[model samples]
Target: MIRADIDPKVGGHFLVIDRRPTGDAVHYGVFLELRRPRRMVFCFSAAEHDHNADRIQIDIEPLAEGTRLTLSHEMCSEWGQFEEQTRQGWVHVMQGLERELDAMQVVSVPEIVAQVAGEPSKASAP
Candidate 1:
């Protein structure tokens, strides 16, 4: 099973907390990436199972106030069978990500404006 935790914080940053289990093994990784409200790109990889898995790339574009997120997994041969499952798995995760991003809009807009105003962002505040 694959599990993921997403926390969309202040500023244009988001955190990806993920864990995956296969047989007797578990893999985990965290991704922090920049987002432009409706657009974003992040780095992601699994060390335990597919050590050679390349970083995943995500792009989200605005669609009627909401966003459409597209995820691409590169260097698939390195992951062997895991590639297929990973692709399918992302479909589900992307859905959740969209929901989270949608919810984050409430805070992200204000944070973005505050940053544009040249003030210290809450994300960077001590």
Candidate 2:
């Protein structure tokens, strides 16, 4: 989560520090195409490398309950053998996101006021 800056336009550069089980690695690339809030096409690789490793395409589809995410990573033939490991890494990252989403909560205005005034919040009154 170190970098979340997207230009939301075509040919925009993007860089981020990616932390994974393999340790912290930076993801560096540029956006190839941007379709607003629906889809994004970006090519990235380890910051240590001189060239790109994968071009990731993300497609978001709205659903009844939530949203369906389709992620496709296109990589070089040289990196073909580590595909399973790459898949597992993505799974780990998504699980982390899910946990964070679960802990998200909204505080009401009253609650904000109480905290600001150093006053305890009252239960819903009759």
Candidate 3:
């Protein structure tokens, strides 16, 4: 669930509520610090273990050929052990993004370019 301004500004806020995959609990947060078209930061939490909530930041950059996406998670040392698991999750998300883009005829991902041993699809790049 999200409730916010139709056009978000720097001080705008949004609430996100989602059910955990296991359906054992709910996760939610208020995301603010918006920088239009470039960055946004949010905190993610599951009700039972609020201490583990992390500040998640997403940055988007326009490249010469396509767009670059970077994700960062800020958490305490207690969550350090889950780093690799977090990375794998991001990988899955990116692959899903690639497929969604494909369906929309959007840009190809870096992984696909590597697979072809060549440049990305022209239509998909720009």
Candidate 4:
């Protein structure tokens, strides 16, 4: 999953690509609409798998400077007994995402600019 666009006020959109356990890309779709730092709704349909699978909705809320994220997946009827496995998969993915965001926060723009400016420019050194 990758953020394609973000409005900050209205919402954001993401481009999601799914790969099977066999290392083959099986699904590609977009998260249509999302409210910035709040809610997101997305649908996935694999060309090689279930074409009519239900959509997934994710909601996020700010909690004491951090964020609380919730995920609701529709169309569990298709998975039968594997529904629990799917839920567990989402939990792992969510944890990974949280860690990624936390790491990103450590790199500020000003620090990046300072680091870049400290490097020797090709044009000239002033």
Candidate 5:
């Protein structure tokens, strides 16, 4: 993401601008609920298709080994055609998050760009 302006409290707003090969994708949202380290609910919408905003809920659970994160995104029927892409996007985001948490180091945008551009990611290494 090129820019991420977020306020993490309930009712707060957020704007994230991601650099994509096609162009910058803008996503904006409002936090509906927030329970620190446990659960979060938000309204998410893209700049290109804001008519039908989606609701996303994330639940984080404690595990002996690590954390288990469960994310549920309720997309508008209009977005059904892009389900696979949306799923993949979430997978990439979660993988990035896991990497950052595991390494305890920040991952640069350039590295993410390269990964999205088809460079092999460390997760896929032998």
Candidate 6:
């Protein structure tokens, strides 16, 4: 991402600008839920496709070795043509999250936001 303006509290808003190979992509959304260490739900959409905004839900579960993050994105039917692209985007994002977690050894809202914004998180283990 090129830049990010985020407020992670429930009902808060976020704006993220990503620099892709093709061009710059802008995404913005509002936080719907923020159950720390458990789940988060937010409205997600590109600036151009804001009319078809989708809700993305992330569920975090603890495991013996580590944590498992399950993501569900309920996209609008209007984005059918971009379905594959969207799926790839999610995959790429998850991969990035994994990389960030590996580097920071933590997973939280602030760290996640930092990861997406291409910044190293200052968050430490609690």
Best by TM-score: 5
- Model 5 C-alpha lDDT versus the unseen true structure: 0.72
Clashing pairs in 2: none
* Native-referenced Cα lDDT, model 6: 0.71
At residue 19, give the lDDT of candidate 3: 45
- List TM-scores for all candidates, in order: 0.46, 0.66, 0.61, 0.58, 0.79, 0.78
- Extract clashing residue pairs from model 4: none
Question: What local lDDT score does residue 2 receive in model 6, on the 0 to 100 scale?
Answer: 87
Q: Please, what are the lDDT tens digits per residue for candidate 5 over residues 1-126?
A: 899999989989999999999999999999999998788899788853465677787887665555567787777676677777877898789788777765765432222211222221112111
Lowest summed lDDT over 10 consecutive residues: which window, candidate 5? 117-126
Q: Which TM-score value belongs to model 1?
A: 0.46
Q: Candidate 2 local accuracy as lDDT? A: 0.60
Q: Kindly report which residue stretches of model 3 are placed more than 4 angstroms away from their true locations once superposed.
A: 1-25, 48-52, 106-126
Question: Candidate 1's error at 16, in angstroms?
Answer: 7.4
Off-target runs (Cα >4 Å) in candidate 5 are 48-51, 105-126
Query: Residue 7 in candidate 2 has what lDDT?
Result: 56
- Pairs clashing within candidate 1: none
Model 1, clash count? 0
The Cα local distance difference test for each model comes to: 0.43, 0.60, 0.55, 0.49, 0.72, 0.71
For model 3, the run of ten residues with the poorest summed lDDT: 117-126
Model 6, residue 2: distance off in Å is 0.7
Query: In candidate 4, residue 117 scores what lDDT?
Result: 16
lDDT of 3 by residue, 46-65 (tens): 44336456666778777767
| Predicted candidate 2, C-alpha RMSD | 17.1
